[model samples]
Target: MPPSLPPRRKSNTGVIVTVTLVAVLAVVGALTTVLVVMDDKKSNSVADSGYNYESQAPTPTRTYDPGPSSEAITPTQPPSAASSTPRATTRTTTTSTPSGPRPVLKTKDNPLFLGENGTNVVTCNLPKWQSTPTAAQAFFTAALPCLEAAWQPVMQRANLPYQRPKLVFPSGKRWSSGCGDVTEGEAAAFYCPPDGAIYMPFEGLNVQANKNMIGSYLSVFAHEFGHHIQALSGAMKAAYQQAYEVGPDTAAGLEISRREELQAQCFSGMWFAAAWNGKGSITDTVVRDMLEDGYQRGDDNNPSAPRDHGKRQNYGAWQKQGYEKNRTYQCNTYLAPASSVS
Candidate 1:
């Protein structure tokens, strides 16, 4: 009577049910995988918004070892026996020769060092000649203090302290500076932050003067001092940092250097403004002459030569901007438009 009873029940129902369950599971896994891929793509699309993937490579860090300390420098003899006398008196003598205009002698008060006034007056005595090493040192000393004075208020306004830098006057032959050894021919001017000092070889000033280029001498000091301003204002560190990130030869790197240099020229102008206002002695002719000389030395158009500094036109424009505006903000070549720098 129901031979069917045995087999009908156990028929293939169980096998079919097992197979259907397995197939449903497989389909669900495929859908899960597709959903996961879609979510990943959506996340990446959001992350890449407004970013140039190709050009946004990570910047490399720059490693630098601090340079050596400044060598011990001995003070040289003064132009006359003035070194021996205490409370020294400086006289300004004007001599009119067959030449167009003679150099004007200006006396500078003794420098105040380490909160002590005139401690090193004997060593700070300037030579008789305006272009002499003594004179250059004296000029630098005077200008250095003035620069500090000018920047002090500005820095203080920004809640920054004034850090004074040491000035080193080296002779022509061979001298040791914070940066390293410098020879007579290589004797331009430079600031070494590692040593916190500025190095100026008397021979460099003399050479420029002999070439009828005394203006270049002033510009050199201005440039070196400009470096000092950078050190104090954190501008120098920022520039180096930028250069390290962008590479020294890139457009950004060049812009950093140009900004520093142009600011120095502006500082030079500030000095002139102070001199003009206080003494009423710095004539427009003198400023023009100095500016022209600075331009000549700064010519960067010579592609064969090193274009790290700037061109003559660039120097002139920067100087003029500083002289006219007398404001630090205005002299900011880095932030200014290209047309302004040009």
Candidate 2:
């Protein structure tokens, strides 16, 4: 091929140099543009892959004691559910975003339901369970800090006060607190708002009546912690006052109690979801044991028992909802229908 020449000109040398410079500049600019586009795409790819729940660490398989109890022991009562008139009122929080201030959603109106999603708590290494008060006490003491850490962000986001409640492992079958005297049979474990302490009597756990799995116990503790969440968020006091005004033992009052209880169950499930396969000790098998125990914790089958907690199906249903969904707003039982909570 023959190279083409420019038209005859008086300053051909200068024109040739100018044309060569322009061509070189064009190549350099094109290369720069390609590099910039490639770099931008690389940055976007990294940003898009940010911390997904599904990308968490694999839960290590742990050996569980398969010895099943004759009957599952129900998580009987949250002391706050009892007939107590609370003077405190329901507290609401406001949310802000780029657009403008947003009022809480009607369905997830509770203050605790502010976060985008529930948190995966820090790695937790729980002590072995020997079915003794001392062992249980140690396990719970170690766990309280983790719970505090996990919920701290949510509370802060909601503009709610966050603090660790007192953890008390009562010794005897019958024990009394600022709330009232409670027997082992009445409440497996309870949260008392007066002293802001979680009461976990060894007898109340009924460790013998269930599989010896740590996650099962953790779920129970988390459920009671759910009550403390209610108390701190003013949900407990507000629900109590409403129930008291309508008579705590009446149908309406019981329905309110069921919503409170089931919501706690949902919260418990969220905790399990956060911890399972993401942190220490909580594995799929552990969650399985917990769910198996939880399925039987409902009050439906027992004729004599008060229907404060939902049916066994709904009982497990809400927990799985929290676990699978892993969102605080999704656990709102208050907005649920009478049939669903019932």
Candidate 3:
């Protein structure tokens, strides 16, 4: 296939920007996330979980030790997951809420309900599958049009203004952009709201995941896009404020972070389902890989890691909850039982 003429640029003239910063909840490297103010005036750098962003470098100055207080992590429950069909599994309790205000979903009335048979399902027009950077870049190139068809209605339904986010897939062990450059393993893939773009370096999948399964890689892309959904919905701002109100690593703050991360998972599942059902290339095998990938990424899988994201069971459940159930309401971790969210 050949390239098409450039699409028109979207205007960000009067959209309000906030001082809050946030990112996908995980720890591969430094985990110091840089976020954008709601306004595009400038992007702000902040740690992924903690309030501030110290300088970033290829060499990690700080240990991944978020902190210590006997909230030692739970083990990663093995995923009995296979294909798109989900299985019921037991969940583990990991956090105890100290007496404080719990985080709430910012918008009670959102128009993001897309069920299995819902409207606006868009089939992806992906290029021939290959494990190379050029192939992956072309994959996203085709995927974005489908994304626009599937997600724009979600924003419009909520009566919020929407715009296409920027995209970049730099090739190297290190690169710098709207978000500061840290070295490899610090981040595999992440969304920076300030720059309004999704950053996907080649190593994100090729090295970090150590496997070249396209389905799993696409899930990462969709997850980051899910963050874009949050930024556009104002949910990111509310969650950031809530996290700041309570310390980011505290029990409350971690729960808020988990809910945020889990919601992103749910959103990823939602979009994937729509694309798959609408003649997308996600096969049953790809669905299995996606689950296995989610299982491995669970925070509880790593004992020394922070439980900023939920355990494997909950992580798998929330994703399945979105895919199997299809409704956004079912994906609301903020309003869920702490046990389910944990």
The digit string of per-residue lDDT tens for model 1 on 135-159 reads: 6677667666545554455444333
TM-score of 3: 0.67
Q: Provide TM-scores for the models.
A: 0.57, 0.68, 0.67
How do the residues 63-98 of candidate 2 rate in per-residue lDDT, one tens digit apiece? 111122222111222223123232223435534322
Worst 10 residues of 3 by lDDT: 36-45
Q: Give each model's whole-structure lDDT.
A: 0.38, 0.50, 0.50
206-271 per-residue lDDT for model 3 (tens digits):
433334466566666766677777776656667767777897779997787767666766666666
By the TM-score metric, which is better: model 1 or model 2? 2
Under the 3 Å rule for N, CA and C atoms, how many clashes does model 1 have?
Answer: 1
Worst 10 residues of 2 by lDDT: 21-30
Candidate 2 regions exceeding 4 Å error are 1-108
TM-score of 2: 0.68
